[model samples]
Target: MTLKRIPYDKPVLFFGNIRDLFLQKVTLHEFMKSYYMRYNNSNHSICGLYVGRLPVYQVMDFNLTKDICNRDFDHFMDRVPLGMQSTDILADLLLLSPGPIWKPTRAMVSPAFSSGKLKAMDVVIQSCGEKMSQHLLKRENPDKEIEMKQLFGIFTLDVLTNCIFGIDSNPWKELNSELIAAFYDCENYSILTHLKMNAAYWFFPENLRRFLKVSVLADDSVYFAANIIRNAREYRLTNNQRRNDFLQLLIDNAAKEEVKKPENRLMDEKHILSQSILFILAGFKTTATLLKFVSYELAVNPEIQNTLRAEIKSVLEKHNNVLNYDTIQEMPYLEMVLLETLRKHPPIPRFDRCCIKDYKVRGIDLVIEKGTMVYFSIIGFHHDPRYFPNPEKFNPLRFQENRNPHGFFVFGSGPRNCIGQKFALIVAKYAMVYILKDFGFFSTNKTQVPVLGKNGNLDILIHPKM
Candidate 1:
């Protein structure tokens, strides 16, 4: 209740905002954007609110957001803890692990996405994109209104499975493959499940929540995923096979860690399994969602689409019509279109960082205490007219002329940013180029002129309604 005393641009309402969010009165992004606008002109750039009893400070100023994420990253190095019990596989995720566990795991995983590693994985990505495009072309009614989310979901899942696990899921051929089934099960939650989770999140203490074993993922799906990884590892070792993929990279790292001292070992079986699952979950839906939006945007804006297609054509011609790492990098207009799409529809609406040390704002009297959750709304920043004029308009030219890195939180900012960003972009761009080169996207009767988005339960990314 003491958090209510903190200076706020609007009347301090302890439970009003959270109550609206829990009751589904307002989507999470809408709440954040409204708060951001309410506080944008205030002397202080931060506003206080309560998520249940937990006090959270929402950062509104772009400069302050930059400082917290980049300049003073050490003071806010870790995300707000999910508070899952130690035994849960989610506990060891690099996204949720504390500084000590996260640091070394990040170091090990970072190399897997390096320029060389990505170049090596380019073939796999291109193959998946080609399969998707071929499938689309083969469809009985090519111009029929196709649900792009499902289509891109298949492509992204195929790409992730191949590039991460070195397994050809062949999602194009078998839509209900075991891998796809498990992933869908993990994400599929019923209305009752959502109600239970909302109740627990708002009312249950961390210890009690963990005691109840309330997990965002289904237990059976987790077991199935774990078994898949274990099987893959055994098969690789038994066959003496080597692959240039994320799982193989982790397997090699784990092998190297065996000789290191216990304190020095960066990865083990649990680390590998958890990180592999995290990468799959993290990359799958977000990239699919990005591609879906990009496709939709191009469908509606044919001029921009044609311009982007011309660029893609020119770049691929220079690279001998091969959609490779270098080819993707040469398409600057593609980059701008992607950036504009991300600006309009950031997969993750809100992200947070926990204050590890009490820190005073440089220009304000407020001091955010250690352990307080600091929230950043990607919707607020991306849609702010001050930073992005006519934010609602789908114009890639904004990125071409005046782009502010600080205002962009699509991949997030600073050290704790999404590590798989490059890989995600590569996959998305390859798919776009491959499909656009052969087919043109045009809006249909079912196409939502201005796409609407809905927040999913426990989803870091927002899902669009086509």
Candidate 2:
């Protein structure tokens, strides 16, 4: 049962030979399509890979990705080397850790994301959505296109404040609040930070948590969060009242940690504080990127936008403009629109898993030696015409009709898939529902055409310019 190998072209594999690794601009979708066509047509089919200090492989096969991400996961379980372990705490979160540490942390964190908790947090998320609508209305001028990146960032910041910190940052305020200022600093990915990331994989792997020196907020941000978490925990304890927010759930669960691990440092003060910081930082930026991309897609495709708005109106009339768990769940068109956006622009483009032991992929008896990096190309698969027909077009019908059920893998798959997928979906949906009900998304001349991602150390995380 030997599987076919897709041959790699030497010329393209030598992709980054120039003086600039950060500025190498290649149209990724176009590049992948050509690679897929060549492999599909070739007699000796093989996957293409770019060999360098890092063996970056670009695979377009959905079957192979499932094998790497699920069936053959033992061989491919660790995220790619971001640099060193000592510097990147965001990466250090459950998404980036290995084996024993990851498994237990996952077990503990899983309960926090249950449907009950998501339901409880709905009001907090809905509050943010209400603010986002007002915020957008204030910015609207006929025919004026606002740079949505910053605006979406503010919207997501408000969402994260309520979700994670249980407070309102009002990031949409004319004068930036302290929370907004810290959030802005946290979002800026500088060259020095990039170098520290590379250092994480090369030097101090365990010590290079994302809370280190990625930005000034990485350190100072933690301090502010500690005080917040402390006050919240104390308030919850002092008053026998409970709220439906992320902070409360985490704190409540933190108290029961000793029951699970009597020998370990159960959810102590530092642990709770660190987890809070991780949630605020990781959740906001990634969700904001998704929301902005969705908005951009709507702006560019007015027809699809009109169709969706119609559905939103029809559904809201059915449920009286209140998007409850049942109502938001019923909007299939909205789901399809989001699916299309995710397929076209996945926030985290690539995922990696390090080989923990020798293993096989599909029927191929290859050496999955320890330390072998098995990378999953999320964008490559999402854009591949094999899974998605007419990949570039803003067609929501692909998801609306369940034409390609296994096509989308934006939030990832398997056990390690994003725990916050439900959280992200609800936030984006409510935000869209509120904004579209009031204002229509329009394109501006200042908007950058064919949005380009800045290529460098942080290439795995894609950010769009407004």
Candidate 3:
């Protein structure tokens, strides 16, 4: 089949003019959406462009996204291999594994985020939230303007440390928490860095990049994290500690253990470390980022924030001033606000997949040759006017029922969707509910409300209601 010529503002290079636009501090996904809208007049979803010598497709259409992600999973079993250049410990993580190993690894790791498991972990998350509450309370001025991102980062790091490592990385007890510092270091990614991070996948491919000795992480932060997980695993196994957390679950069938039965050995200490790193990525910065964005959206939109507060207060009253798993599910408005926040600003701006087989386009006669890389613009789909009314506006009501799963790819969709989705959401809710219950938010004099600015300060003063 023949492909339609993608309208270009400039000739194709590694980025063509998209790089220039992106350097203007706009996200690549936003730039692509703006470019596509301005250039295209057709209803078609798929378009082709060249990134360096590679032929890349930017797919924003939900139908096309569904097909690539779910309907025809066999055709695109592996992700586009971004940030998997090293043969280091991260390669064993589910994120970089191709189809063959991904299935089994996913199955082993999936149970860690089960409903019962997250419920048990919620008590830990709530305790972390309580520590965060005390932290905020201890501020010299309770109503002082603060950078919410850092606060949320501490909160999420606390939760992830407890859930993933079964150890408290509590900044309250340890002033110089390297774990917290390492979590911040892992967040060294931005729109500017995304280009370099993804370039290897665009040209070298993952295997060749590994062959060329390319590494994804810059400093020793990953190694530091792995060491922590290793110690935690050793301590847990030695003491026979039975914490209902991720490390404990993985240790049950650890890869290092010698299992005579083939069905027994699905993971090992390396897998645990890899997934611990993954948890640090997914549960730490990304979750904290979500909280900040949700707060920012609420700060800019007062009515919506008040409405959410009403729901939170009502839910707390129903639970007799307690925040627990069952009560969290009662706050539909809270759920809506978070969902709308995700739709407005998905945690990861975009997702990609590498076509593993020569797959024929369902409607067209052309075949996407094996190894061709494709990117799905989460920003494009979230902002599409057809799917989201007043797409720029923050309307929580839009997600009350959440029937439009395919149309909204926040946690992603299909077999390759985020495994820790439920865990992340539950933890985030625990933090948000705790914060919103005691405090009221308003704009600080210096705060500039950001829609999705990567570097925007977004400081807001939080005051406890009298």
Candidate 4:
């Protein structure tokens, strides 16, 4: 047997970019940015690299990147498989499932996040935000520095548990919450955990990894979440209970006839369970990270913060001092702040897709072969001075003029973009409005500045140097 390889003339990293990532020399995001700066040229739109023996193509040109993600989406419909489908329940997640499974599942889950559904879910989010603001207002030491990440984590968990599982979990009161413990455990961000994941990606063969049960999620966490979902589903069915939650939507929409049809697979119990878990996993950490970044920005940029607060107040006053879906959408400056925060500190800084069919470059002599991995650096485009001038400076005004730029991929682009984006925005916006209504974030001596972020399974872990 002979080895197969794509002919490449542009910059190539022979040993692949994984070496620096494994050595902690640079993060996944940083490596991509560095590669773009070093090898990106007007001649070629793509670069060549390897993850161990597997060949990978890094897209550098913005037009070509747009084509891959949007125009030529059918040729690259699915993401690079994680090779854990047989052993891990998480493999079935909408974020991980193959195109066959992803298409119908995405269609089924999409309605659950519709404008009407989000409007109904606004009450639940408002309740959670109210509780969080109340807790902050009651803080014994007003001058004491608050850990915004932890606070936002609690707020997001509370909202997700209530909306996704229909569990009224007051995370603020239950600091030692069992559900919280399971969530963090399932999405572990420790260096060792990431190392294990990289080992699986770079070294272990797919068959061997499955034989050894090299799972991405923790066993205990999976079991805990499974039990909770099963119990909630069973109780609702038995009692004929209906609630305004994602779980309820799934149950109601579950197919009753021709259930064995391939197209109806999303209605299966297993798929529904998988999607429920995914909603929590996707919504929890990312939304919290957005809140943390926004808070940090507001603390450091007091003038922008004040302008945002004024917008929030004006919107609320017009809407009878109510924080709901309609009122949230009315606050344009608040949206600008969130947009700038996402640009600077995107929770997921990079995205990948796998070529399903051989795709020839329109004007070049390159053909992306089937099963080849394609990578795009969102942070690179986000921070590019060409797209965002003075990218390092937090300027909400930049967004005020151009709300959606071609380079902006915070929620991603094209058909496979994030489905829960509107849901996440509503939750974050409500929390910001509720908190800023009474409290203002200000920097103190204890305040820490974010220098870099350590990549996690589902999001980036923002780390500050002491």
Candidate 5:
């Protein structure tokens, strides 16, 4: 057995070069390119890296990612959501739990997302999408420049609140509400806050993190988010009423009594709260981002947008002007456009796993030590030329053409990929279809044509959809 030292790329920081990427303030794709080029090894030479003194093994090769995330699932089974072990609800989240905690939790929670369950919720999602369209229409002033993300953000908030709380009211319609205030208070969207948060997540000492009990989310936000779940569950238990929504699923599956065993992790109230909050956090931002990018792409590519509108019209006619899960699924071009959007602008830029056992890198003689964190580069691969021809160019045809499906890592690859991917796609497509069916998104004077913003962020403008 030989332990060969992995190649290193000199980082320009006291801690390590990892934070340098954040400091440069580049898009996720650009940051990956900078390192991938600087390292400049077709082989896995630069796969192991130091981000601010943190040793992280980044898998750049597609096959290697498949090996680590899929073929060797048992060896690399944990995702570092917060920290591996914490008394906080972060530890109990379906996304964060690994191995002993993750396996059972996944099974218990899987039923909530079955095909039948999702179909039941689409009715509400459709209504929310309609509400979103109406909201846009009410504010349809061409002179007044509107940022699409804000509108999409409100839309996502409405949809998620309806699904999670089973309440038809628009949470965003009235910003003065205590819960809304709590959400905003918890989230500090300033660039500086983001940099600091990234640094803390990447470089701050674990002991200090635990000692200070530092959390990226604010306590008020957590309290408010948890309270929503509490009130809903209490009401459900008191009344014995069941609704066709995720909240109902959580209540039904959640343990009525306090949980005594590790296997029954989903039974506890804290667990319910964590899952509920995660649903809101996860569903809101990413889906909103997707809508923004998709709209921007459609606006820029008017021809494609027109084609899509026609297709949406045709599909609605086929369904007799009814919007549902089945109708959204029927539109292939819409699906293609969204898929391309994901490929070009992936919400989540990276995938990670914790090495549970000593595993040998296939095709290469390297042993990834246990307890090591491995990252699969979603951004790098998405922009890779080998997989996608003219990777920078926006082309939905790539999906229609016969290209390697493995190249696209938007939702990610293998068993641990996004559980809510189908549902997310369904909701995104529904909103997109409805928006395009009635309105046309073209470049406005305030429009930032590029998908990536000036500062490596998503900042686009819209003057009414038509």
Candidate 6:
């Protein structure tokens, strides 16, 4: 089907010049909502745009979105609009890789994220939570504007480092903790990284990205991680001790695969090292952003905060104040609050799927052609009043009723949904329990209301105002 261009009189997307692009850039999610309100009155609607040099389609209806994500899964497997160039720094990680490569890599990493494994890592999770509570307790002054976002970042780092890499980084104790410093250093210099790290392999001859010396890991980051992984591997080999951390799991699986399939080689040291770094990226930033958002919502909605606090107190008292997987799982209200927050402020606002084969949308019979990028507006669907009544109200009861499966897709849907969703929820829940049990969280003037993201930090991931 052809794109229908609405007249200039319409209040949707009326771009006359490059300057209009600036006006549209205020808040992307809001801009899309306005467009949807203007043109999308039915179950299915389309909007076309130029995202850099590529053509893109924005799909609003949840049915078409689910069709691309589930029913037409194969055709929509690996097409994120930004594109994953084979030579990019994250090409080896499951998040960026596509097709055959993503399949095996995802398989190798999947078991480590299983619920059983997360349960096994309970000690690390509890330890990190206790550490965060102790740290926050010491600084309980009311007037002081504590940066909860930064605090949550530290908590997430501590959890991921210990659980994944079998290391401990106390970012709360030292803001510039080695791992935290390394992460932000890489983040600050991200644009400079690709050129510096993979220029010879990825960049085109005349491209400006060639001049940007951006390494996947900054010098300090590389030294820190490379040393940790190299030493950990050496330690495992020397001591013959097997830990249940993600690093150990990867090594065991890789070794097992090597024995099972003599023809194809298993993951080697570089692969393990790359995946470990990927775990840090996947685990820390997104989880931290989620926790921060939950905190923001909790701060504004005191009644919900009190309700969550009561639930945590009751659950912990039942389990003798021990945060185990089973006890935490039993906390329904807590889960609903977290679920509601996810619905309101999803970590990843949008998902892009490529149409690998022609498929007709149900009811409409409109054929989505191969190579067309299908953009799913996850935030749009979550906030749509069709499923969530009084959408703007911060209410957790919607999730309690099992209102609609397609409506609450914060972690995405189908097979290709984020594998680390369970792990992220575990981290957020554990941290929330700790904070609520000990102290109260309130937003200060520094905490920006109607939170907007900083310019350079706008990937698929979400970051709240600090």
Indicate the worst ten consecutive residues by lDDT in candidate 2.
Answer: 456-465
What is the lDDT, from 0 to 100, of the residue 12 in candidate 4?
28
Indicate the residue-level lDDT of 325 in model 2: 69
Question: What TM value does model 2 have?
Answer: 0.82
lDDT of each: 0.79, 0.63, 0.74, 0.77, 0.71, 0.69
lDDT of 2 at 8: 59
Candidate 3 residue-wise lDDT, 1-466, digit = tens:
2234443344455554455543445656566567556533465667765654456777747787888888999999898765444637876768878898899888877888888887788678888999988887888877678887788888888888888778887876664577677767774666556566556555554456565544455446788888888888888778877788888778876634466555565576677788778877667767888898888887778888888888889878877898789889898888778888888877687778888998877775557888888877677778777788798888888986663554688777779988887887887788778888888777867688553465578788878853
State the lDDT of candidate 1 residue by residue for 240-333, as single tens digits: 9999899998998888877676666667778888899889977887898888888888877879988998898898888788777876888888
RMSD of each: 4.0, 5.8, 2.9, 4.3, 3.3, 5.7
Which candidate, 2 or 5, would have the higher lDDT against the true structure?
A: 5
- Model 2: lDDT equals 0.63
Which residue ranges in model 1 land beyond 4 Å of their true spot?
A: 4-16, 206-210, 262-266, 401-404, 454-466
Where does the lowest 10-residue lDDT sum fall in candidate 3? 1-10
TM-score of candidate 1 on Cα atoms, chains taken together: 0.92
Among all windows of ten consecutive residues in candidate 1, which has the lowest summed lDDT? 457-466
List the lowest-lDDT window of 10 residues for candidate 6: 457-466
Error of 6 at 192 (Å): 8.7
RMSD of 6: 5.7
Residue 219 C-alpha lDDT in model 5: 59
| Candidate 1 vs 5: which has more TM-score | 1
Ranking by TM-score: 1, 3, 4, 5, 6, 2
Residues 91-210 of candidate 5 have per-residue lDDT tens digits of 467777767776766666677678887788887888888787776677746456556766677777777788767866575577466655665455555677667666766677666555
The candidate, 1 or 6, that scores higher on TM-score is 1
Model 5 scores worst on lDDT over the 10 consecutive residues at 454-463
lDDT of 5 at 310: 91
